[model samples]
Target chain A: MAERKVTVTSEVGLHARPAATFVQTAAKAPFDVMIAKVDGPPVNAKSILAVLSLDVEQGDFIVVSAEGEGADELLDQLVEIVSAP
Target chain B: MGQVPTAPPPTLTGTGVSPGIGYGPARVLVLDVPEPEAGARHDGDARAERERAEWALEQVAADLEARGARVGGEAEQVLHAQAMMARDPELATRTGELIDRGVAAPRAVFAAFGTYRGLLAAAGGYLGERVADLDDVRDRVIALLTGRPLPGAAEFAAAGSGMGVTTPFVLVARDLAPADTALLSPDAVAAFVTEQGGPTSHTAILARSLGVPAVVGCTGATAIPPGVPLLVDGAGGSVRLSPPAHEVARARRVARAGRAVLPAVSSTQVSGSHLFRRGMTADGHAVPLLANIGGPRDVESALAYGAEGVGLFRTEFLFLGRAAAPSVAEQAEAYRAVFEAFPGDRVVVRTLDAGADKPLAFLPPSGVEPNPALGERGLRLLRRHRDVMNVQLAALAAAATKTSAKAQVMAPMVATAEEAEWFALACRTAGLASPGIMIEVPAAALRAADLIGAVDFLSIGTNDLTQYALAADRQVGSVAGLQDPWHPAVLDLVAATASAASGAGKGCGVCGEAAADPVLACVFVGMGVTSLSMAAPALPAVRAALIRHALAQCAAAASAARSARSAVDARAAAEAALSRT
Candidate 1:
């Protein structure tokens, strides 16, 4: 499994346009991807409803993990989207 | 349309938030999306039921995407996000599991959405607002499964067509949600009449922004069957159902005349016809008209409406929806933009009015109280967090120094002479030339003389004053009738504050929805209010009304209104007094 932790840097946090972009990208990945806050249970990354329910505000740390052929590449892309200013 | 009624059409009254006249066929928005029965069960074939549920969700998602594609912009992004929620994989999986347990498609979808609903509602803040969006998606899928017309689908379809409905129509509803009005266009809908909403409600604000005539809180608005001919007078707050031909013709003529008087954007020539250039009475009482603006973006409209200056420059925009307070330099730049727009004119900047309904993430209250409105807010919150207030005052002073415009600062929700003195001293310490406090609390108005001695001027925020005085929440639709600023009690408070300011020779201004009403504007000037500020769109009519009446006539109207017992009676008495030229 490829895992990475990234702090949400966007002013609106992991919501609105950022959340939509994150979910759309994760949905396109061939492997199963999951995400959660540091102490919260993991939820499907491709599910906008689940990701939004987590309510990860700006400056909060979130962990993303995926296991498959392109898991590492997908994790890097997801981290880049959340960490972008 | 609905068989010309044999009876004389009834006239419904509501609060007029936006001013104008419109006559059109009524198109009532139906939002009766029924919930599925809790125990509703599918047939023995679970596979077929699950496919039906999945198909309905996909259909709703596709419909949302198609609508988003049609209206491409910021709205498109919101609709796309809603579509994503409809297609959430976890949601589909959960629904399918419920269906396999023998629950019907709609029931399964409802149960699945309910689980996430609880989670989102618990999260609160920005995520809490999204609960509505999530519910919208869930309702749409269920609406599709149940074979019912989607809520707001007709309105969106009509708005999708570039110019709007083939014939303009008056939209009637219980109340409008954000999704219901996502595609609303000014040209498409002639007017708006809602059964519920106060002057500050979403329907009122949206109607004002669209420049459409609107009447809210009408008793029987939603009961009016679709396609009935209706005549709406937004200023008079009247909706006449199935009006006679002559009445409709008269309304049309009045609307045309109103449209003709709009101030030309490029004209600098001030003549008798261009009366909106200045605010004065028929006998030459100079009461400057200003604009109540949210930020720098509204400066152009304020200028277009011939505003002398900005009466209320709400600084909360800079602090809201952010994790931390903006840096002093960033705040200064924003303030400077507004000051530069009206050089040589006074821009009254209101310090942060956070707390209560508008709590900031960085500045939470010391403890949760049963009532936030009466709790730590405005100056109370600032006193506890002096660092935030000091930074804001420093920004205002820096911005004022950089521009030719005079910057006068004020504090909101100040309730005592001591609090007013504290705010005034803070302003002077920061090098701000003038400091004032808003008379939004009855306590401040009752002791206005003492409060006036502590500050340079007084600005009455009638919205809050009415809310506090009558013990009515401004946002609650059921108590909207009591939110009228024309109530004798509310007017009495205004008179007290204005008289106190006049006695001390300090400028007293009104920057509230009351100032937007033409008749009320005249009465306010009569009561010795030196200035009136409101939304830019309302400037022309108010200027015209003021120019037609002398200061003595306005004073007579003011006294006549104050002698009345109820808000409705007060308005009628004032109109009668003003018309006796």
Candidate 2:
């Protein structure tokens, strides 16, 4: 599994459109993906409810982990989306 | 059930905040969605119950997507985003989990959303706003399960129905949320009547901006049965339920005449022959007409409608909804865009006016405030976050050097001479020469002389002045009648501030919703206001009204209005004086 921690910086954290967009992107990957608040249990990244339930807000750090052929590339893409304003 | 008796036709009165008249079939908006019965269990068929819940969720999601497809642009984007929330896989799984526990579908769906709602509400500000959108989705699903029609969802459903209303319908509601109102257009909703909200409420403001007739604070507005014809006299603040046919005919005639005159005054494109000139009274007193703009995008319309300069450039657009403040260079570029729009003209930029009703995520208020209207906002927030103010001032200074337009910066919510002096010194230190303060607070207006001594100029935000002067919350519709700028007490403050600015040999400008009123614009000029800044579309009417009267006439009207006992009386006095001259 490839895991990376990044801070959410999109002002509204991962709520509403941002969270939905994030999940839609993660679902497109052909692998199992999960996200968790720092030191919290990981939830399915493809689940909008699970992503929102984590309650990741701006300036809060979260870890993204996935196991697949392109796990490293997928984590990088997810990190970029979460960090960009 | 017993047959309900036909009640006598009633006339509900409210504060008429927007002008004009409209009549159409009442389309009462329902806002509240009741929670399903708690812990209500389904029959032991777990598989069947889960399938029922899934079907409702899918139906709601499909309905939202259909609405989004029907209403393109921003509304479509918002609706489509909501559909995603409806189809949230995690929400479905959790809801299924609850159904498996023998909970009813509606209760299960409600409980599943509640878990996420707590987290978002705690985050506050922008995230807090999402809670409403989330609740909206939840309500739609629950409504589906309970076989009840959703409130705001009815409009979309109606539009999707093949047999929608051919004529625009009158929107009647207990109150309108700004978010919901943003999606409605004048073409769809002919007028607005709300049981709550004052003249300064969001419903009233949106009506005026959309050029729709509106009555706010209307008693029992929500009781008007949907599909019953309603005659709304927006200027009179009255709604006649099931008005006589003859009355409707007469009102339609008057409304037609009113509409015919509106385009001549509002649509600059339609009146292509209309010349753009400096704003002046008939007696040749120059009252510079300026536009109150949100961002650079509004400049074209402002200039098209003959805006001599930018009067009040609200910087909130750049700061709101952002996780972090923009870099000085980025801020300067945005400021430069507005300056470049009007070369050799004045652009008075108001520093970020966030807090109270318009809170920002990055700069949240310290604690829960009982009354946010009285909380630390505007300059007070900047004072706490000095770096924010410094970067903004630096950006303004940088932009000024790159453009020909005269750049003037002002601070909002300044209460004392000390704050004025501090802001002035900071602007000077940041290499900006022109620094001013808004006279919004009653304290600032009362001691305008001392503050004017510190700053270069003064701008009166009558909206805040009226709210502060009358001790009424601008956001509260119940006390909206008290939030009138025409109140003698509010006029007294304006006169005091203008007189002080005149005495100090500094320019005084009016840059609030009050300036948009053509009659009040003349009153402002008579009170020694050197400039009037308002929304772009309102410029032409104010110009025409000013050109129709001389300086002496305006001064007389202003004096007459100032002596009146109440807001209504003051307005009548001003109108009588202006017409008599």
Candidate 3:
């Protein structure tokens, strides 16, 4: 499994447009992708409802993980989206 | 039936949140989306009911996307996100499961949404607010299933059609939900009148952003029958119902003339227009008009509105919403950008002002106090965290060396001359020039001469001065009326501060909401305030007002205002004096 921990820097955190874009990107992955708060249970990253329910805010840290080829590239893309202002 | 002669409809009054005039037919927004019955059950065939629920959600999602495409920009992004909520897979699955258990489609959808609503509401703050958006989506789906018209659907459709309607509507409502306003544009809604809302309400903020005239907290506004000709004066806070044809014509003529007199001034054409290029009185006393900005992002609007320079460049933006203070290099980069925007012009940068309403995560207070407002904040917070203050000062010094902009630094919430001296010495050590201190505390204003002697200049923050002098908490709504800077007591403090700065042969500037008021701008100049700075959008009006009156008239008006006992009387006296020769 390829995993990366990134901080959400956008003022609204992982919600609104950012959450929608995140979920849409995860849906494009060939295999299942998972996301969770540090030390929290993982949930399906492609589910918009699950991501929003996490209620992640600005300055929060979250872990994204995926297994298979191209997993590193996908995780890198997700990290860029969350960290961009 | 023949037309019967009747008395004129009564005029309704409310607080004017946005400034403009609008005349149009009343279109009352009815929010009557009924909740689906909880015990409702589907027929024996659960599969058909499940398909019906899925179909309804899909239709609502497609409709939202269509409206979003028509209203491009920020509104479009909002509608698109709402559409996502409508087609959420989790929502669809939950509804399908409920339908399989013999629950009706409408009831199943409602229950499914209710679960998410509870979770968002429990999360509070920004997340809590999203519950409203979720509820809006749920209401739309249920309305479709029950065969009822979606609330505000007609207005949304009209706004999205983009076919310039013959006469725009003056939307009258009890209060508008975000969904109702997401698709509305200025062309479709001439004005907005609501029965409940204050100056800071969502409706007021949205109306101002869209530049649409709006009146809020209007009693009897929703009672007005639809299609009645309503004339709204947003500045005057009056809504005249079924006004005479002649009166409406005259009002429209006046509004048109006002617009013609002050077309939006752009930076490219500012040099060509002599009247707006500089802030000067009729007698030609120059008082440079500046803009109060948060950071570099605001430079474009400030330049667009022809800001001569930056009056109050708040440095707190760099420190806010962060785990720690930004590095010196990062801070210098941000400051340099702002300084570069206005080459050869003054840029007064206020140091990190966090505490009270705005507390930083890294910088904690010494102890818990009964009142945070009166506790250690601003300069006091920086004093304890000297490393933080030194880094900021070094960054300012570094940025100033790289730009031609005349960078000036100041400390906020300085109560005594000793604090002013301490801050000034620190700036001098860091090689920053002309360090000043804000006169927000009553003690600072009362002993302005002593404090002014310690700094290079003085900037009067009238908002905090008013709050401190009148013993009124600015955050409390009930005490908001007391927060008026026009109060004679607050005016007295301003006069003292400006006089002290002048006595010390230093510049004095007013950088508060009070300066945005054109009439008050003139009065500040009269009280010996050498400069006026406000939000960029208010520059044109203040410049226009200043150029219409001479320095002597403004002084007389200031004197007249000081003699009055109350804020209302003071404003009236000043207006009366300025009107006279």
- How do all the candidates rank in terms of DockQ, highest first? 1, 2, 3
Every candidate's lDDT? 0.85, 0.83, 0.83
Deviation of model 1 at B424, angstroms = 6.9
* Pairs of residues clashing in candidate 1: none
- Tens-digit lDDT track for model 2 on B1-581? 11222453578888787777888898877666788778799987889999999998899889888887876644565677678778877888989999999999999999988987887788665566668778989988988888866666566345324236588888888787554554454567778999888877778766765667899988777767778888888889989888899999998898788656744643443345443357888777888999987777577778877889999998876774344678899899999999999999999999998888777656767777778889989998899889889999999999999899999999999999999999999999999999999999999998999899888999999989999899988877667768889999999999999999999999999998899999999999999999999877678788878877889999999999999999999999999999985
Each candidate's number of clashing pairs is 0, 2, 0
Which residue pairs in candidate 2 collide?
A: B197-B477, B198-B477
True contacts reproduced, candidate 3: 0.52
RMSD of each: 5.9, 5.6, 8.2
TM-score of chain A of 2: 0.95
- Superior candidate under TM-score, 2 versus 3: 2
Per-residue lDDT tens digits of candidate 2, residues A1-85? Answer: 9999998998668865577678888988898899999889999998776787677878999999999999999899899889878
Weakest 10 consecutive residues of candidate 3 chain B by summed lDDT:
B1-10
TM agreement with the true structure for every prediction: 0.77, 0.78, 0.64
CAPRI quality band, candidate 3: acceptable
lDDT of 3 by residue, B265-371 (tens): 32233445655579888888999999987677678878987789999998766775344578999999999999999999999999998777666645767766569
Q: What is the lDDT of candidate 3?
A: 0.83
Best model per DockQ: 1
Q: Rank the candidates by TM-score, best first.
A: 2, 1, 3
